[model samples]
Target chain A: MALTFKPLADRVVIEPVAAETKTASGIYIPDSAKEKPQQGKVIAVGKGTKEHDMTVAEGDMVLYGKFSGTELKLDGKDYLIMRETEILGIL
Target chain B: MALTFKPLADRVVIEPVAAETKTASGIYIPDSAKEKPQQGKVIAVGKGTKEHDMTVAEGDMVLYGKFSGTELKLDGKDYLIMRETEILGIL
Candidate 1:
């Protein structure tokens, strides 16, 4: 879904992949025990500075650092705002 | 000074610039009140993954986010380990 947010300067808005609700053994994972997901889909990207090139594009799936990015809630949906460098690999 | 630590894959080692001890208006800033410095000089860098290009090099002064990176101490000096993407700009 598209929104009205616009990031600035190599920053990106990412929608994280949801954590697994159940294990392969059919045990329900409690919310407190759910791991933070490290994968996401790029939603928005900022224009890169003159010194740096922006390579990530919208709709790209990416891997990021475990603690990278700031969490935000927009329109009741969660998103992360991080520099493009915080992305480890483009999947 | 050189060290033996080598970072892995898109990570970088940085020596943070010292926080200002005094304000420009002649007010002495105590250690507890010192702001986290957001600038540093790159000391080491990891080889980037095949998808991400490694563009930063040692000795390049850079600006980073206030809360970015992990703190470490080597040879009695402090350093930070962060991905190259945590860097906001190269100075």
Candidate 2:
């Protein structure tokens, strides 16, 4: 499915990756202690603000703040919309 | 004393107005119950970003979020430095 929503300003639309339920050492993590996912794939990007240029491109894996972005649902899929500044780095 | 600090981007420096310790009905508010001040006077404004223009001027009374801005101390005075977007309105 295609995303029809367009973000404005420095905002970007992200498709969140599922939170990992297992630790790197093969330990299972319980739901009660699972942290919010902080990684996502860039789906859409806005024409950056005048002072800053867009640095991320579509399909890039990125790291962001755990609590960043507003939740959105489109075409039966979940997404997030937030400013590029909230994205900490491109992975 | 004149302020020598200049903020970059769309940031602004604000001198917070003291929080009222007394209620409008003349009741004294306890320290634990007093809210952080949300009103301040604009001391300096940065050149706005490309997508937006500066709307506030120096010495303008403004309102902002209670948790907005980074705390700053200059010339023995406390101040807040935040982006113009954090400013809710000019009073």
Candidate 3:
């Protein structure tokens, strides 16, 4: 399913990758113990403002966070990703 | 305990308010179904960059996120929050 909000100029929509549960000892780590990934998938993209060297687009997964970006929930599923500037790198 | 990294300047350290489990129906919401908070505390801050309007500082809980910021794990505990610019607002 697609998000209703389309990221605007230089922004991108992302769905962060799921976190892992197993610890190094093979113990199941609860969500309380895991850090969110600083990465995600680019769902929609705004034509980057022609201000800097922009290099991301729709469908491109990226690494971000200076850390930056907004979080959004839609259709009962949670997804994120924000301004391309918020994106630290393209993965 | 204070984070080892002291936010250099405008940044403030924050411990995000934990998320609530259970829907309105009181059904437990699994970690897999939850979104990480797009907010955090200022751990270490660089003195606010003088070029723009610097409106944040250490210990001042701010509402940030374009949404933006980084995630870092220290001593096995996870913490987040980034530049004042990344912070959308002060709480």
> What would the TM-scores of all predictions be?
0.45, 0.44, 0.39
Compared with the true structure, what per-residue lDDT tens digits does model 2 show for residues A1-91?
6677889999999998654433232222223423322557899999988767787789876545567999998888889999987664444
Which lDDT tens digits does candidate 3 get at residues B1-91?
A: 6567765554444554343332232222234433433333445556554543344445544334423555667767776756554553332
**Residues A1-91 of candidate 3: C-alpha lDDT, one tens digit per residue:** 5434434345566777544434333433234543433656677665444464457766775655524665554335556646677776665
- Identify the superior model by TM-score, candidate 2 or candidate 3: 2
Q: Please give, for residues B1-91, the per-residue lDDT of candidate 1 as tens digits.
A: 6778999998999998654432222222123423222556799999887755676789876556678999999899999999877775453
Candidate 2 ranges beyond 4 A from true positions: A1-91, B21-37
Every model: Cα RMSD to truth:
11.9, 11.9, 13.6
- Steric collisions counted per model: 1, 3, 29
Q: Say which candidate scores most in TM-score.
A: 1
Candidate number with greatest lDDT: 2
Relative to the unseen true structure, what is the C-alpha lDDT of residue B3 in candidate 2, on a scale of 0 to 100? 62
Expressed as tens digits, the lDDT of each residue in A1-91 for candidate 1 is 4555556467888998754444333433234553433777788887775567888999887768768887644444667778898898776
Pairs of residues at least 3 apart in sequence or in different chains that clash in candidate 2: A50-B50, A50-B51, A51-B50
User: Which is the better candidate, 1 or 2, if ranked by TM-score?
Assistant: 1
Cα lDDT tens digits, model 2, B1-91, are 5665556557788998755544344533233544443777899887666777899999987878778876654444667778899898877
